[model samples]
Target: MPWGEIKDTAAERRMFQRRTLVMLGVAVLLLGVLIGRMYQLQVTEHDTYRTLSDKNRVQVQSVPPTRGLIYDRNGVLLAENRPVFSVTLVPERVAGMDATLEKLQQLLSISEEDLDRFRRRLREPRRPYQELPLRYDLTEGEIARLAVHRHELPGVEVAAELVRYYPHGELTAHALGYVGRINRQELQRIDPVNYAGSNYIGKTGIEAFYEEVLHGKVGYQHVETNARGRTLRVLERQNPVPGEDLQLHLDIRLQQLAHELLDGRRGAIVAIDPNTGGLLALASVPGFDANLFVTGIGVQAYRELRDSHDKPLFNRALGGQYPPASTVKPMMAIAALDSGVIGRHETIWDPGYFQLTKGGHRYRDWKRGGHGWVDLIKAVAESCDTYFYDVAVRMGVDVIHEYLDQFGFGRNDALDVRGARSGLLPSPDWKRGAHSQPWYPGDTVNMGIGQGFMLATPLQLATATAVIANDGVWRQPRLLKDVVGDTPLDEVLPKATRDNVILKNPDDWNFVTKSMIEVMHGRRGSARRASVGASYTMAGKSGTAQVFSLGQDEEYNAEEIEERLRDHALFVGFAPVVDPQIVVSVIIENGGGGSSAAAPVVRALFDAWLEGFADEETGAELAAAGSAGESSG
Candidate 1:
């Protein structure tokens, strides 16, 4: 009876109503939170989300600039750009690089080298979406195969780019140098934004020296891409500035002639336009094709070049240091005359040899018996070693170093010849520091003959000869002739570091010039035979740089020694002997005699230059070509 009386209908109704209302409140609160979050994402943070979405579809790319054209002074193309197809891959777009690379190797039939280089490049620093090259210069069949499978490969594509090409690859290799793939060290130093897509960089010679001028400004583009990073269309574009075209002082005809003269022999020939100091021909024999290096040479090909017996890669004209031998006699003759060490008519008697002080060391003359009585003019003409020995002893090394330095000896005097060696110029102080020995009188005697410690490069010899041809003016040797741009050629080149060597008597220059002429036309001149049929007056001095020193009693027998052990033939001189046009220095490695081997080469060069450049307009042509050539712009 008590339980029945305790039942409450109002309380039960109130409890049900409270539970329903609480559930309704919870649902409304959750709905409101969801609505606010959706509004924040859709309207409040609209820009942020849209930008994030666009980043996936739109991409910015760096466009590499077109490398400049290189031309000879006569408008002959030396270096130009040719388009090629390359296999490229973007790592960010590649889901699995190693797996993707494996796919590419199979599809393109890529070599181990290409794969290896690709892996190496991947490890190197690169931009976010930069295409790393997998294979270069793809064949038509290879391109077709890649296209068929390109859809299957998400991050891989074929790219077209202009690669450096040398039209006269073997002929102009050392003169113009070459470009190759950029390395890790180069990547780090170059501007990250500008060089993003530039893969090649100048490696040596003129290419390396004028890289900034050769490589134009980089451009950019905005492109729309698909999910796999394939470009659908370019949204915006910026054109790249092409590198400036350069007209070099090189004469291809002269270059070809110099190379022909050096054929079947190891040697170098450096020709300079004396009036302008422009390098006409810089030839080093056994040259390699520069085009091989442009797109990255194969391992086997590079190894072959690196290990060749001829050393084709070596720049003999700029780097070969040989004894200038009798070639420097002309320079020394002026040094002796101006320094007052020898009178113009002073005679030095020779009975084939000279002793340092009675019987110390009988330095033998080139001629077996004697030059009889050799005056300054006679000594230079005859290449009388005994006379020069006497003058060298009288002048001493101090005076010699002083005068030779002014003539561009013992130092690289080229304005744009990169990698040239500063050949050793021995001095008393240099002797003390280098060998820890005192300067001996015998050293001075050897210096007289351009033996012992003296060394000079072909460029140095040419530069010195140029001074004589240029009338004691030291115009620095250079390669740049003109530019096809707004910039002046003078402003582009380095300021010539020169010390005009004005002799005490201006007549001394003429006297020295005449003596050198005798070296070509005189009856007793060493190079007289080579000058027999010349239409123009020429001046030259022949020299023999002994590869192996002879003992005091030993005589030189060219036939007995190995060809490599024979004396190196050298000759330096200029043509016409009046307002001279071309100055040349020739060095023949292991050639028997200067008069026989080197003199003929110089004579040929002289004949080619004088005869080819000869005409009524020769003077004007010479002046335009000689006058630190201005740009056509």
Candidate 2:
């Protein structure tokens, strides 16, 4: 204490005062800096920070537009959309996808198919924050379970969407097709921005043809979300534009009738309006329930359809390529008459078979014993193979090819009919390019009878028959009737794209039509039995296509051959000879004889079209279709 007290008292006081002043100065400098920073944050950058805060709570979402509805000519619902609840997940909002999926599985049932579809889609290109469906058409119990655990799982929601539903799935499966979930390949092909929030797309038939018109414009909305990524409210929204409705020429009653007529048979039926090329009915038997593919078909179920011996998926009306058989006789008659290969009263001698020369391969006729002497009308009515064989040789393959092409053979020119095959209309050039061989005389003879190298689809046959009914007018077949949109039906329908079959003699059409009528009502008409109860004039040609060729002298014995190896029965016809109400083509696979099998089928369909279905019968039939559900799965 004595040593410390030695310091000067004045010096100690001065030092304390200096230190206090220095501390005060430093404090004032720090206060100045803090004031500057406060000014910068509160005034200069206020908008930036406010925007950042809003972004954390708000989100922009895409709203998918409603798809179009499809109806038949009679206003029957062919394809419609039914509301379905689905479980969906937003990946970005999820804390941990693996953990969330595991938790979801524990709460409800999830099929391996749904999981596979989800996992596969997750790898595909998609818009930001898109919701992926985990399960579709959830059961009430599953929905309850999901609802109870909704708060436990983040980024999970139950969504309702209109899914494609076909009331008469089996009846219109091939004609109307069905929608399916978008896949990775489709993602690359479709417009990402436009298709945003849309799950399904048309896969085939008219659905695919009019997809652009059916899929309406997308919309947008700004929504406010909570801290937990749950949507609180919509801040702003643009209402989505619903797709336009479509009306088709397809008659639901006719479609059902066609399916019924083809029941228990493997075949196809194509009916069309001759005046306008609208299809009344297009049916392929052993059809599947298109709904199976809408959400997702089960693995086993798909395998069964793919491996079934019946080939239910095959579009026989548009795709089955068989020899046109004697169904082409009328067309050949026109070719022969117009080309001067034969006259209207052309005569030929038949002795049960045709010979190219004095001694050549004898092509046996359907009638083992022959029609003896026959004129053009009698030949066409009796389907005399000898008469056609002679004219085909004179006309040559090129002439035959040219005439057949004019009738829409060897190519698919229908404006809206999809999945049709361009059947072979063999010519010398085609033979050379395809088989690297010259067209043989026998090949030409076979073409005359719609065999050897000539093949056509049931649709093609129907169209050709329609040309006759329309009096040489060429109108491409179409399924679309009218669109309920800004665009009118005429604007939507393509203009005439083909030429009418003109002849040197305009009366040739009348002559050929008369000959075709003879094939139905003439005393020796092949299809006379089918025309027995007809109240109106009818014209038809029955045809039988051999599944296997016979030897020169081999006789056809239906009982001796396997049923599957029997001839394919075919018939093409149009009724009310004057106005020609409807044109139909029927093909039955392995159905023994044309007159016995296909002719009756055509007769029934024609009667339905002309006479119209009874109201009571239609109700009962529709009820049956609804009950059947068209779903084997």
Candidate 3:
């Protein structure tokens, strides 16, 4: 056989050509697939991948607005903001949260409470990469320490924010209140959009009442960051709107005087402008420093305040429910006169006591020797319990209840005052509802003396006295005098409804005013000594509320009882009687006599306000009164 014929050269060439064609076709398919995938990645899904990459380099942040400033009527700063440095952590960026927190604790003096609060916030639902505050108000040393160790930390940051500060410290604590770190409850209620970066919220008093107006709109910023999430530069920013400034009706001078007068005593004083219903001063002695509560108060510090006998944290001016005592005599006198139970010239005889029936229980008078024969004016001037007791019996309980109600005895409709208590005014129905007891004639006698279940707050007393000073025009008491912002005060706050307390005879107001005047200026007046050096004409009533009842034959000797068990001295007054300006109510807890303790305090306030802080025209009148010494005469 020939080798060329056996090899089949022609068929071998055809097989090689077929193999080459198949390999070239497979190569072409793979090239085409690679081109398609490259096109898809670079063109079709470009926006999606670019966005994902940019997220690692750029970040959007919420910019918190600055909180509002609080000022007194004279523009003295009450509450302001100060820059504070805080340590924060982003949980998602943190490599080992437990280890990081442990390191932070060692580096800075992180309290267990701080760590606990931090852990709570860390567990809460929040936006990814949001910084959570761990320790606030960092000292310079702590901040430097954190900076030194920044390279080793991944998510830890030293951030700066504005924190609330009270310049006056304990002086304006009760009135202005304080702002604190936002808590779980507040977070649930606050606007997430507006408060996105806000960490603090108002907790009480005016701060709490005007929270919305003080917390302005939030803003935003875009920043570029590196691999470690450190902000390199701001890409974009929207300036935040600062909160509105507040101007309170509080007179710092008068407020300071009230505190000085009440120093070393457990007491409260409230003063109001009769014409405007603006709060002039609200003072509760033994006040605690409000700044402590702003940045999270210590357990030990808070415990001391909570347990202290002085009750420094307690707001006594609007919350203290005390017996008004003879301070309400003028109001009761109005009731008596309006009911026709007594006339201006009505006289009552006292043998040191009065009985509802012959041989019944004798309601003893404050003066053991009795006031002798007393007319309506004399009774009011001397605070004769016997005269009130007789009129109370004759007018009955229902009439007394109706008349006193018109004077705001049992209610507080003051719009700006957030937590004023509605004092208890007892009636036949109230007695039955509260104690399941029937009304008795003796109860009316006790009510006439502002005793036995009649409770009133210092604010209520001031407001009622203001009504008298305004000549029966009932203006609800208020703390807010004006708003210094875009928002109208009425639109921002609830409207305070006004009404007139019209007496059957308008002369009744004049009659009561004159009687009150005599109480301060009359020779035999109970508060005559207190009025001796006053410049302007002041009308007032002094009272001693018994802390405990005396036996039928027992006499009250203040020296015999414990100081806390002694009577509470009280006084309510309005100055420049004809055209009254300020009305004041004061209570000295456990003080022996209203005339000696409370009246002196009132007189001092009246002098400070009328002589020291009054307008130019009013000051002239006060100067004339001081020179003439008509009050002394």
Point out the higher-scoring one by TM-score: 1 or 2. 2
Clashes of 3: 0
Total clashes in model 1, counting residue pairs 3 or more apart in sequence or in different chains: 0
lDDT of 1 at 340: 98
Candidate 1 local lDDT, 365-444, one digit each (tens): 87778879889898888888899899999999999999989898899889998989999889999999999999999899
Q: Say which candidate scores most in TM-score.
A: 2
List the global CA lDDT of all models: 0.86, 0.85, 0.85
Cα displacement (angstroms), candidate 2, residue 311, comes to 0.7
Model 1 lDDT-worst window of ten: 624-633
Would you list the rank order by TM-score, best first? 2, 3, 1
lDDT measured at residue 301 in model 3 versus the true structure, 0 to 100: 93
lDDT by residue (tens digit), candidate 3, 474-551 = 778777777788888778867767677888898998899999898889987887877876778999988888889999
List where candidate 2 sits over 4 angstroms from the true fold: 1-42, 615-633
What TM-scores do the predictions have?
Answer: 0.92, 0.94, 0.93
Instruction: Give lDDT tens digits, candidate 2, residues 1-101.
Output: 79668978899899999999999899998998898888888889888887888899998888999999999998888888899999999898888989998
| Candidate 2: count of backbone clashes, pairs at least 3 residues apart or interchain | 0
The TM-score that candidate 2 achieves is: 0.94
